[model samples]
Target: MPAPPPPSAAVPRRRWQSRLSPTLVRDRCYTRSFHSAGLRPAAVPLPDGAVVHLWLPPTAATGANPLHPVLLLHGFGATATWQWAPFLRPLLAAGLAPYVPDLIFFGASASPAADRSPAYQAACIAAAMTALPSAPQRYAVVGVSYGGFVAYHLAHAFPEAVERLVLIAAGVCLEEADLAAGLFAVEDIAEAASLLLPQRPEDLRRLVGLTFCRPPRFMPSCFIRDYIRVMCTENVKEKTELLYVLINGRKLSDLPKISQQTLIIWGEQDRVFPLELGLRLKRHLGDTSELIVVKDAGHAINREKPAELCRLIKNYIVDPSVKYRDDRKGSWKNAIKRFVGSSLRKVDSSRPLL
Candidate 1:
């Protein structure tokens, strides 16, 4: 009763057990994955005093492969490592050198500048890439969710450097009015920010539920608390500012369509940024872009459908001519069957099977 037994002496056994963080364990696994894929972490300091942290290929200087340098940009919630670790080995197997970066205000990357626009993020990324030793003249960019916004702006800002584009579950076509019109479950940007940058365990759970089509069966409360403490607690003000700048007052009319051949991948069951936005983006890009809907996935397609996503990216980036029909309603194979059957009725019956 008197002073509650000094602070350190009163620590509970359960509290001590919670200190063995699952978040830190998973983070170590992510680091191991990156290292196994031959990627080493580096920090690139910009002229504006911001430092961009990246996982760079082993052959960055001497034996760099100019033809297959690919930049991977992650979304909100976690660092680039957590979002992109699953992709490294597959990309390397396809002979593509993957460069993964943590965008400003997330992970180890941070900027001192006041500008929080996606365009500024894009410029910082471009500058970091340019500063690399023996940097490739051109590289394909693969952006997921919020990363897609930055990727789109990067392509728009540096057309000469970005050769191809891949956007997954990104709502670049979304406008501020869409929020007012109820395109999202959240009522407004403030609610959205709270959900994204969660401060409480329940909020993190809610975010995970919205992000994954099949959320994990069980997540320990301690793990959630540890995650929120380690991942979501830092740079809180700056991260919130980034979110406000991303969604506030944005307009489709002001969005520029990139000239690069684009591959847009969306989750069929995405609730965060609906499939309607993906279709709108395709229509806005006209013939320059192709839309592919990953079946049975939600907002977290990278986690939910990593194999399929990697396959799509590899096929598109390695050879753009390898076309994949949109599988929105059904499989592309069924579409081919329908097309072939329709064409057969108009053909001569005497035609040979050969």
Candidate 2:
């Protein structure tokens, strides 16, 4: 809206070797729509004595043309204000209606109270939602990054409430030791991995690699820095509350039980949560769910490829059949395209890749 507050820092460029392909160029169109239309924030009270920072649809919302309130959930360290802005315009344009809320510990939401836990946070989100007054009865959700993990649990944990599910860079659980080393630590991913998930390394390493189709050299330092800030900003007084939320937020074993319609999208060239993971998630979710790998998306598709993502999102919610088929066909097309592009570029640059 208002000229973006000057970027916290210059955006880091991908080494020529780490560039995205032409097909991944879905929505490079840029506009100032969202800056002028940001919604006012509201407070959502929870049963556990916590308060969440939420932005509600205009109360003057018209019933004859009321938009469905889309609840957007944030990632592990992100706030509502920081995470959902990129997708807001498309959501608004789609006319499905959307609401962005920061969980208790992350955004403007108050820090955790005595009973805070991941389940407690989830319950708080559920409770805050019940207080909203929007209609046209479409219960659609879109979660970004780690928020995707919560969306998964939310859909499964409260199946009757949500009608559609949108997972962006959705996260899954690992034994800690299984996580990828590149995902954490300000300087050294391996060292950070060892410290954060000492007991479960392999799973974490694989998970981190899955985020990207290919990892970049000299990784985006600025993103990593901002990421560190988000993680560190947690209400320190509620350490246990934040920790609990991180450790137990997702449970993939329960994915098959969710009856809500689901849609999954990832940047095909994403090094954060690779396309293969999206493929596996597709099979596990079955024919009812849809998955698309945003051609050149990294972990932040809304920021990098906002236009295409926005269009896909709008179609996914308003035109269900179209999105479902697009997703089914899209993932396959994008992956093959990414593979070919990588091979060509690798050959041209004389870069070594797997």
Top-scoring candidate (lDDT): 1
Per-residue lDDT of candidate 1, residues 1-354 (tens digit): 556666676577546655587877788899999988888888999999999999888778455565688999999777889999988888888888888999999889999899999999999999999998878889999999889999999999999999999999889988888765656766578888888889998888877887778889899998888888878899988888888999888899989878999988888767778767777898899778877877788888888999889988988898867656444444423323433533221122121100
Give the winner by TM-score: 1
Tens digits of per-residue lDDT, candidate 2, 184-205, equal 2222334333323323334333
lDDT scores of the candidates, listed in order = 0.82, 0.56
Model 2 global lDDT (CA atoms, 0 to 1)? 0.56
Q: In model 2, which runs have C-alpha deviations exceeding 4 angstroms?
A: 1-35, 59-65, 111-118, 133-138, 173-177, 180-231, 236-256, 323-329, 332-354
Clashing pairs in 1: none
Local distance difference test, candidate 1: 0.82
TM-scores of the candidates are 0.87, 0.66
- TM-score of model 1 (CA atoms): 0.87
The Cα error of candidate 1 at residue 314, in Å, is 0.7
